[model samples]
Target: MRQTWRWFGPKDLTSIDDITQAGAEGVVSALHHVPNGVVWTKEEIAKRHSEISTRKDGSASGLTWDVVESLPVTEDMKKQKGDWREHIANYKISMRNLADSGIETICYNFMPVLDWTRTDLRWQVAHGGSCMRFDIADFAAFDIHILKRPGAPADFTNAIADEAGRRFEAMSEDDKKQLARNVTMGLPGSTESMSLEDVQAHLNEYGAISRDQLRQHFIHFLEEVVPTAEDLGLRLCCHPDDPPFALLGLPRIMSTAEDYKYILDAVDSPANGMTFCTGSLGARPDNDLPAIVEQFAEKIHFLHLRNVKRDNDDIMGSFYEAEHLGGDTDMVAVIAAVIKEERRRKAAGRKDWQIPMRPDHGQDILDDLGRRAQPGYPTIGRMKGLAELRGVFTALEHGAFGLK
Candidate 1:
């Protein structure tokens, strides 16, 4: 696997020097300032490329942007409403621009409304460090009382609904506001924050769209852009829904292995693929992580190798970011599967055999809490994770596990 890091451009607290110092081979970033529907112009892409390659002293950073973490798919495109065709055209144009600049892998998502959700951005862990967490009861509390979406209560089981009510009643006004901000903390790359009204409006637009309808729209999207991607020799990978379940009464399509197989079958092409994120998929108790990797190895183009500590055995429940090797996922088995796939691809004489992977989310530990880098993206935290993952990769590659 090619080691990479997700950089949020110049405005990010984690600087280019930090990435290099951490020993990443390449970068994963995007023109985050660019809006969702706008075309990423050649000039803008060039500027970003220069930013990634050149440093403040005009010296080469000895790194290149390996992958576009995301090229935002707007709500209009997902719903197929309000100038969605134009958005699709702009998406194709962006793909062409990115390809022209030597980028071949793109990661995106089809989750509705918020790109991802977490009820607590800094939940304190037993180790005294903090990490992002998702408490189903807290989320339900926001949905039932704070956002007050219609039929929100019906979406939850009676036990969850009751627990949510208790939590809601216990929260102070400031607590409720913080929870709302945490839930709608904007997309990963963008700076814009969504107000409560903004979230409600987005939910309203999708009120009539069912899981099947939203899925077809996703396929339509793939149909429109996957051909262009194929022509450009670009790999388009869709990220699974975080937590891998429904939220705010919205339908989630890309949450399970079956979900991915369905979409992959729908848009069957080399250009269409999956971004295998262990943390996201592992949130669901039923998902066999290593099995899924083996099943879809050929279709996976990118990897987010973070892990999560699930609160319980339930499919939908709380989970917090766990250490790379300390979570529910069998990191050793997963890496073994990936290595096996790489061997298969090598035997087949494939050029793009190595997948690009990033140490996704890390706990906010050590000086990380003070540096206040992006929530889950701490300097020391991720460096620690990458170091651990590199150790695992080296052990597996050298036949230390007896795979030889």
Candidate 2:
């Protein structure tokens, strides 16, 4: 696996120098200042490339923009309304510009309104460090009581609804506002942030759209852009939903193995692929991570190797970010499956056999607690995770296990 780091452009707390010091070989980033649906001009792409490739001293940083974490799909495009076609054309232009800049792998998501949701940005753990968390009852409180989406109660079981009611009743005004902020905090490196009013308006718009219709819109988008990606020899990977389940009554189409198969088969192109995110999919108790890796080995172009400790046995229950190899998903076996696929591709003489991966998220420990870096993208914590992952990859590749 080729290790990379996610950099949030010039203003990111974690600098490019920090990424290199952490031993990452490449950088994953996007143009957060660019408005959604606006075409990414070649001049802008080059400016980003320049920023990543050089330091303040004008020396080579020895890293290139290896992957685009997101070239965001707009809200209009997801709903297939109001200039969605123009957005599609802009997406194609963005793809071509990125490919011309020599960044071939692109990651994007189709999660409506919200990119990823968390109930708490810094939920303290037993280790005295903080991590991002998704508490089901807290989320329900925000949905049913705070956002007050009509019929939101019908989405959750009676047990959860009652628990949410209790939680809402017990919360302070500050706690209630914090919960709302956490849920709609918006994408980390995007030019957008959503207020409660913005979220409620989005929910109102999606009320008339069904799961099936929303899915068709995603497939339609792939059909439009995948061909352009293929022509430019680029790989377009879709990030699965954060919790891999429905939330706030919004449709979640890219949450399961079956969901990925449906979209990949619909577009039926080499360019159409999956960004295998273990933490996101691992939140679901039913997902078999290793098996999914093996099954979709050929189609997975990028990897987000992190883990989550599910708070309960329920599929949509609360969960928090765990150490890279410490979560419920068997990290050893998952990496083994990935290596096995790499071996197959290597034997077949595929040039892109070594997949690019990043330590998705890490716990806040040590100085990380005070650094106040991006919620999940801490310096020391991620370096520790990357070191642990590298250890595993090294041992497995050296035939430590009997597989070879």
Candidate 3:
């Protein structure tokens, strides 16, 4: 795996110095300042790269910008209606520009309403500090107690509803505000944000759409854009739905193996593929991690390796740090499978054999408090994650490939 770290760009508090010091040799970033549905010019891409390269800690030594965490899908594209043709065209142009600037992999997702869901951004970890996790109870609290979207209480069992109500009643005003911000406050690449009123209005817009309809929209969007990506020599990797399920009446696609099969068959293109986030898919026990890795290895261009602890049939939690050999994920089998795929590509003489992998989310530990960067992206946590993953990969390579 070619180790990479996601950076929010020049304005991000995690500077180039921080990233290099943490030992990431590549940056997974995007032109976040650029609005959705707009073309990203070569000059803008060049300028961003130049700024990153010229930082005080200096250039990305053995590093380069090779993957874009996302390029926002415009509302028109997601709805598969209105002036989406223009938006798709702009997306293609942006891909072309990114390709010209040496980016080969682009990570995106088709989840409607929310990009990723987390009940707590600072969920306390057993070791120390905190990390992100999704609690079903918290989500229930938000739906039936906080946001109070219509018919939400029915989505839960009577017992769950009762528990959620109790939890909601116990929360202070500050607790409610934090829960609201954690759920609706858009992250770095996400262009949309919601006030309570805005969240309601957004939900209202999806009233007529069903899960199947949303899937169709995603397929239509991919059919329009994947060919352009192939032409531009860019691999489009769609991230799985975080938590891997529907929430707050919002439809979810890309939550299962069948979803990936449907998507690849819908477009029938290698350029259209999966990012294979373990933490997302691992939230569901039904997903066989090693099997999925082996099955989709050919189509996977990017990987996010993290683990979650499943409490029960739909109730799960994640470890804050990406422990190379800890948590529920079988790190040995996962890394072995990735190496097998890389060997296959090497035998075929492919240049881009090393898959780009990142420690998806990390524990907010050490002296990382009050950092101004994006939440869940604290430096010390990622540094710890990187160190752990490196040790695992080193041992695996030595044992599996007879290389020390």
lDDT of each: 0.92, 0.92, 0.80
Per residue, candidate 2 scores C-alpha lDDT tens digits across 84-138 of 9999999999999999999999999999998898899899989899999999999
lDDT tens per residue, model 1, 71-170: 9999999999999999999999999999999999999999998888999989999989999999999999999999999999998889999999999999
Relative to the true structure, candidate 2 reaches a TM of 0.98
In angstroms, give how far residue 37 of model 2 lies from its true place.
0.7
TM-score of each: 0.98, 0.98, 0.94
Question: Residue 400 lDDT in model 2?
Answer: 58
Judging by TM-score, tell me the better candidate of 1 and 3. Answer: 1
Q: Model 3, which residues run further than 4 Å from truth? A: 57-60, 190-193, 315-324, 399-404
**lDDT accuracy of residue 118 in candidate 3:** 78
| RMSD to the hidden true structure, all candidates | 1.1, 1.3, 2.3
Best by lDDT: 1
> How many clashes would you count in candidate 3?
0
Candidate 3: deviation at residue 370, Å? 3.9
